[model samples]
Target: MRRTTTVWMTGGLGLIAAGVLGMLRDNLVGSAGAPVIAAAAEILAAAALLLFAIGTSRESSVVARRPLGVIALVVLALWPFATQFIGRLLSPSEPIGDLAWSVFGVASVLVPAAAGFIAAVQIARADTVPSPWNRAPLWVFGLHVVAWVVPQLLFAAVGADDIQGLAGLFLTLGKLAYLAGTLGLGIVAVLLANRRRTTTVPVFQSASTDRD
Candidate 1:
């Protein structure tokens, strides 16, 4: 098995850890909450993206996918750090509304979304013989989008202040759903890598058949 396969699988595991951390952070209420824990989520997520990109780049059969993976990882890696900068910019005098952080947030999500799509396309369009895991690429992209966009829309539609009854329930549900989706992406990645290992068996299989 290629070392990169293990790398991708390991990265996926890290991503799941990140999502779990995020969910754990959300559960913290009142004074129990800590931003550092949430920060760990982003840091782990970025590391996962980078590791996955490296694995994809090492795959000999995949061509167009490499550059797209690189682009996606770059955005993913930078995503967590942006929040810190945005935080620093916010003050009593310079409020969130006064700045363009909202726009920045929206655009930031789009960057990974676009790159995910591109990389998925590359996996889909590989010129060589395809692996059963090829569809896994699309699954990775899809889950990532679900994690980002679905929660964003759900939370925004029901503002935090407006939540008196079902909104709070939905807010919690949305957060869980986002984490589940993120977890799903990692699961898919590891499964896909596992499946990829079988691709090498055909050569041995054909040789055995020839001998028989």
Candidate 2:
């Protein structure tokens, strides 16, 4: 394996270990403050590994899907952090009508904007072959969108007094979903990488025999 590939796979392994530990804690009492935090960290780690793996892959010679995916995942992962900044801008007594409008505006705009960013990356690299794991990022993105939506609906249902509260909830869901999807997709990417290698041998062997 190439140096970068080896490094990435190693990173992926580390992330897998972290995720497992997090899961164990999740099952146990006081595993962590919240399941989402652990999950998000794991996803970010996995994404890092996947990015390296892509850098190493021969397929990446033409296109670096892993990098593209990584960027998307990172954006999704940091999504929750944005709430903190947004909250500071709003006054404590902001009207629900204005708050709701603003929240909806950002969501409607940002969600697709993020997705489009990822899609654009993929589209730019359409000429290259994508590893199975490349698709994993998109899955995370999809869930991220749902994550963004659920809290809004919940807030609307409950009639939250503060838009900041609603924003916090949305961020929480989005972060959790982002992490879960990242870990899941990371596993998928590793599996795909291995599977691709496994399958390549037979084709190479057949070609060698034919050449002989």
Best of the candidates, lDDT: 1
lDDT of 1 by residue, 44-102 (tens): 88787666655544563233346664675566567658756876775646555545766
lDDT score, candidate 2, position 149? 72
* TM-score attained by model 1: 0.65
Q: Which 10 consecutive positions of candidate 1 have the poorest summed lDDT? A: 56-65
lDDT of each: 0.64, 0.55
- RMSD value for candidate 2: 7.4
**Which residue pairs collide, candidate 2?**
none
Name the regions of candidate 1 deviating beyond 4 angstroms.
Answer: 30-33, 60-65, 90-99, 105-109, 126-164, 197-212
Query: What TM-score fits each model?
Result: 0.65, 0.51
Error of 2 at 179 (Å): 4.6
